[model samples]
Target: MEWIFILFLLYTLIPVWRQQRIHIARYKTIRKLESNRGSRVITLIHRQESLSFLGIPFRSFINIEDSEQILRAIRLTPDNMPIDLILHTPGGLVLASEQIAVALQKHPAKVTVFVPHYAMSGGTMICLAADEIILDENAVLGPVDPQLGRFPAASILEVIKIKELEHISDDTLIMADIARKAIQQVKTFIKQLLLPKMDEQRAEQLSEILADGRWTHDYPITGEWLKEFGLSVRFGLPKEVYLLMELYPQSPSRRPTVQYIPIPYRVENNDK
Candidate 1:
């Protein structure tokens, strides 16, 4: 009876233990790569929604939880050492993104942001603070236009302005004023994030382009477009980056069936 109880406990804990060991091994691999490159690395990757138990909605973005994680990683890095940031996100709360952007900008070391797939909305805002932005050949950054609930802030204001012009929805006029202010606040915040990389003139120009609702909220801005727009965006793929991405491959479906094959930690240590 005692042996049976021990076996059941081991069976229950082995998977969790193996999963944690794999994570540690991955972190070690990344650290080795960064050491070889003469830099420290931090990753801000959103977990795939497919990892959820069911088809229930899950968010993978820069949020309050990531604030402490990013700061902890930064603290672990030496003050004079350069930092490589791997950013893979769909974006999230504006204040959350701003906090990260400011931290990266204030770091005593050079910060480079690598976008493997895409960084949209508030994610794009964070990249603006990077000294250098590297994107995979097919990666993209999207408009930084703020959203009011499910609608774009600028879009909300436009609707109100149109209503006023057509002399309708007098009761909703106050909402329009709030929307306009919200849009302006977002543009201002983005501009401040870009100030370290570009002058006020260029910052305002780029901020307006990203926040003016000229393009759809999710419109992809390719590396070429970003370079042409005056950003120092380079297009290239780092081998270590590809290796890291392979470790946590994106799920192809919302409900993915996953199997964990347990291996000795020594056998699983080869990340190259």
Candidate 2:
């Protein structure tokens, strides 16, 4: 009985201990990056967190809490210091995103957004306000089109256009009205973020392309396309950025699909 009880305690405490160690390592890496860059480093990474008591993993996004914490970090930094935001979220609430974007836009020092993997929707919006956007060559960004509940705001408007006004339900009609406003609001905000980087004419054009219902909400916008749009985007992130990303391993709910000996290997050039 004593052995069984001891084993149960070990099982419960081991995960907690491992998690604390990961947290410590992550903070150490962030501090190292900051020391090297001489800028305030803030990370808004949202990935599959540790499994719950039920063994189910949950994901995070740019919510109010994220906004609050980031905002506080920004406030703590001096106005003259540059900000290096490492954003790896699937996007979140527009209000929170806007709050962060506006703050970044107004900062006197240069602001850079680093996307190691992907930053969708609201994440894209935040990138717009940055002086420079750094992305991994294979990473992607996403459309900033507004979503109304389960439906895209653009899709909601299309329903009204295709269906007769009388045939549309009262609920759908009400949602369509709100959707129109939401699209306009997002476009206006996007334009503001773009204006600093482009002329008024180009800002208006890019705003329409990103916020209008021209593409699906999850449409992957590559860095090449972003450059063509006249945005200051660059490919390839620093080695430290990739190192920090490894610290954020997702909690796997099932068997691992890929297996490899986790070390660097080099091919020998022995032809000589």
Candidate 3:
């Protein structure tokens, strides 16, 4: 009985130990990356619940508090100082993302995005406004389709299809009908905002792609895809930029580097 109990404890502890080790390793890695980087890197931390701001089990939602914090951080930088934004966001509130993007655009500093992991949905939209986007080989930036609660236009189409199948009437056209409406709604919303910055035809095309487009299976989008969408993207950080900083750590030139912060996940308590 004692041996069995000991074995169970060991088994349980092993996984916990491994998790702790991984967390420590990640912390060390981030610390190393932060060290001796000449540019001012402000990390915008975001880990919000699905709907609420402080609830557990973080989901893809942007809280106003977090948005305000980000804005405040940007304001803290001295006037005329060049800064870089190393963004790593899976995307949250569309409005919040827009607010941040606008601030970046208005800032005296140049805006650049560095994606070491994944930036999807609103993340990709934010990258669009950037002066340059730096993507690692493993990094992925994808689909900017806005979702209402949990329903994208595609999901709304699925729901309409189910309703039509159940009703079995002229209502069979409902799914197609709903899709059209959804597409128009998305297009209007995007056009009002993006049209001013982009060519009208290009903006419309992007809006359609975002509304009904499928999720990307490929993690990091190919350079061709980015260029096709009219984005200025580059593979890997420039060697000379890194080298220049290494040489002049004290008198380092200011450049925009968006800091990517990891979202925290909550563990469910079965006992609760």
Write model 1 residue lDDT over 1-272, tens digit each, in one string.
Answer: 99999988887777567557658877877987787879988888875533333334455778888877888888888889998998888899888888888888888988999999999988898898888899999999999887877777777777765654667566456666777887788889888878766789988898899988999988998989878767788988677886677666454564767768754355456678
Q: Clashing residue pairs in candidate 3, if any?
A: 83-256, 84-256, 84-257, 85-257, 85-258, 86-257, 86-258, 86-259
Candidate 3 residue lDDT tens string, 152-191: 6566566655764656555435545665665566456655
Q: Candidate 3: lDDT of 99? A: 74
- Total backbone collisions for each predicted model: 0, 0, 8
Question: Which residue runs of candidate 3 sit more than 4 Å off their true CA positions?
Answer: 1-39, 45-61, 158-198, 216-220, 238-272
Kindly list the per-residue Cα lDDT of model 2 for residues 38-80, writing each as its tens digit.
9999999888867453446787988989889988998999999
Candidate 1 vs candidate 2, lDDT winner: 2
Q: Report how far residue 2 has shifted in candidate 3, in Å.
A: 27
The estimated TM-scores of all candidates read: 0.81, 0.96, 0.56
Worst 10 residues of 1 by lDDT: 49-58
- CA RMSD, predictions in order: 6.8, 1.3, 14.4
| The 10-residue segment with the lowest total lDDT in model 3 | 244-253
Who is ahead in lDDT, 2 or 3?
2
Clashing pairs for model 2 are none
CA deviation > 4 Å runs, candidate 1: 1-15, 49-57, 165-174, 251-272
- CA lDDT, candidate 1, residue 90: 86
On TM-score, the leading prediction is 2
Instruction: Please identify model 2 stretches exceeding 4 Å from their true place.
Output: 51-54
lDDT for position 229 in model 3 = 68
